[model samples]
Target chain A: AQSVSQHNHHVILSEAASLELGCNYSYGGTVNLFWYVQYPGQHLQLLLKYFSGDPLVKGIKGFEAEFIKSKFSFNLRKPSVQWSDTAEYFCAVTSGGSNDYKLSFGAGTTVTVRA
Target chain B: NAGVTQTPKFRVLKTGQSMTLLCAQDMNHEYMYWYRQDPGMGLRLIHYSVGEGTTAKGEVPDGYNVSRLKKQNFLLGLESAAPSQTSVYFCASSYSSSGGLAKNIQYFGAGTRLSVL
Candidate 1:
């Protein structure tokens, strides 16, 4: 079965520090990738998505991810982080083809930014 | 619009008790899904509905039942709750764009946190 893996379980960083969360997937066909973020007491929101075209996709809150097909990876990155960025991030994938439309999500990474 | 809304933000149930989670969406989305969120387990789909009156099982459907009697409503029921069923539940909906086309992003509810003893 297809699955997503996020290497980091938890990450702590000072405000203004750069951030990167690793995500890898196991799927042989074309896939649509996404990054979702959940802030404290808020619903999960889409940060960015990579459907086709550009490998580098920019999302809300200055977050971006690069889809590397060969590596089967779509890692989320931000040059600088803010205290408000402290939240949980999830990576998801959906293979192309039928309208099965199911998303496979990674375990998730919790980031804590200290001021 | 209230994209997706789930009722009873928090609930406590004892083993063998039963309850139903109500999910409503005003976006006129054609697809709705129920998922459980647990620590270390991002989100496991429990059940989904493609359209009104149609329901299907998802990744983790055991111990859960679903009904989509109305297009804007999807209900997830726990016939007999267990401690293992304690977790945060989320409801989401999305529009179907057809045949390999990119679908609308899923809109999630704030989530219902359920504790079973």
Candidate 2:
């Protein structure tokens, strides 16, 4: 089973500040990466995903992520964050091929964007 | 369209009590999943189903049982609840992409917050 690791447990930043949340996973085989965001009292929503092609993928709400296979990292980044960006971010991974039913998620990073 | 729906948005149970969590999807997806989200632990897979009548154990399936009698519904049952089982439960559904041709993204439902006391 693959294990995902999120570097920061909590992050605090002011509005318009750049944001980056580090995420790493442990798996040697072909893996699909994703970033999910959970707003306060809301369900988890897809931010972005990287299956193949360009390592960098753009997602909703101006969020982006870069998948570096060499480092087993898929870090979420945003150049300028808004107060609404305050949410819990999770990194998830699933092995490629037919066995993609299970998703391994990281511990999660809570980002608080101050206005 | 209701992609996925979970019943009993908030539930509180006593220890050793039994309860069931219902997850329904109208997307006609082949894959359904049950996960528990804790404060620090993002989300841990409890159980999953591949097709209408097939079920599989995930990373943390202990104390949990799942059944998928119908194609659109998945039920998660806890025979005896424990305090450690208290967490926000989420149900998700996704279409099975074949031959790695497309993305197998899962759609989640508004979580069911469960508290076992």
Candidate 3:
């Protein structure tokens, strides 16, 4: 089974501060990477995903992620953040073939942006 | 449009009690999955169904059973609840396309919080 590791457990930043969350997976083959965010009392929503294309993928709310195959990492980043961006972020990965139906998720990173 | 819906938003069970969690999807997806989320353990898959009448085990499937009688409905059952089973359960569904960029993008439910004492 593929495993995902998130570098940070919790992060705090002020408004307009740059934010970056580190995520790495343990798969070496073809893989699909994703970032999902869950706001307070809300279900998880897709931030972005990378299948097979440019390493850098942009998502909603000014969020973007870079998929570095060499490092086995797909890190999420945002130049500026707002109070609304304060939520729990999860990094997930799924490989090809019969195992595509399963997604292995990271432990998650909680971001708190103070306004 | 309710993409995926999980019944009984909150549930409490005794040590030996039995309960079922219901999941329904209106998007006509071919794949459905059940996962449990703990404090810092992230989400762990308990069971999944590729199509109607077909189910498979995931990373953590012990003490849990699942049934897919209809294409739109998936049921997860616990014959005897345990404290370790206490967590927020989420149901997700995704369209099964052979070769598409949006094939496995899962849509998740609001989740059901379960507590076993």
Candidate 4:
């Protein structure tokens, strides 16, 4: 079974402030990691994913995440934030290496970007 | 192309009432999924289908049933609606490769907000 955990429940940041949201996962086998964002009145959108190759993955709207294998973490980061960035972020995982594509999602992190 | 579309944007049902939610995707993806989202709970998988005429249970399939009669359509049914079944349901699809690494970049619908009184 694959599970995901997001450390922060709610985050409040000012515009132009750096941002980092913690995410961790536990699965016996290898797993694929992803970060998804849900803006107000919108469906969940894919931020970025880490399947293979480079651990540092960049996403739309200036968002990025690093996949640390040793720590079993895939934390989302951004150099600067905007008020429009306010949204709920989710971390998800799926079994890797020919396993079925069943996604397990985290509780989510609510970001409130103050302008 | 309409990536994924869910019908009945909002619904309210009385206890013991039954209803069905419709989902359609035009991307010709191979994998389709149904999930429910609640406050603080994120998205929990209810059921999924790999292809037409095939359906499988997911993390939270006890209270819900799903069917994939056609390749582009997936239906989720609530036989006996309960208060616990009230949630925002989302449908998603992905193009899964036949071999290693199924490539799971899911495209999601706007979601259906269902409330059971």
For model 3, how does the per-residue alpha-carbon lDDT over A39-113 read when each residue is reduced to its tens digit?
A: 988889999998878999999999999999999999999999999999999999999554476889999999999
Among the numbered candidates, top lDDT falls to 3
What is the Cα-based lDDT of residue B116 in candidate 4?
100
DockQ for candidate 1, please give it.
Answer: 0.64
Lowest-lDDT window of 10 residues in candidate 1 chain B?
B96-105
Instruction: Single out the weakest 10-residue window by summed lDDT for candidate 2 chain B.
Output: B95-104
What DockQ does each candidate score versus the true complex, computed on alpha carbons?
0.64, 0.66, 0.60, 0.69
Query: Model 1 over residues B1-117: C-alpha lDDT tens digits?
Result: 888999999999999999999999999988999999999999988999989999999999999999999999999999999999999999999887755444536889999999999
Scored against the true structure, residue A107 in model 4 reaches a CA lDDT of 93
Descending-DockQ candidate ranking: 4, 2, 1, 3
Going through the candidates in order, the fraction of native interface contacts each one reproduces equals 0.58, 0.67, 0.52, 0.62
Classify candidate 4 by CAPRI docking class.
medium
Ranking by TM-score: 1, 3, 4, 2
Please tell me which model should have the higher DockQ, number 2 or number 3.
2
lDDT of 4 at A96: 80
TM-score, predicted candidate 1 vs. hidden true structure: 0.97
Which one is best on DockQ? Answer: 4
Q: What is the lDDT of residue A8 in candidate 2?
A: 99
The list of candidate 1 runs beyond 4 A from truth reads none
Residue A76 of model 4 has an lDDT of 100
Better of 1 and 3 by lDDT: 3
Candidate 3 docking DockQ: 0.60
Cα lDDT, model 1, residue B87: 98
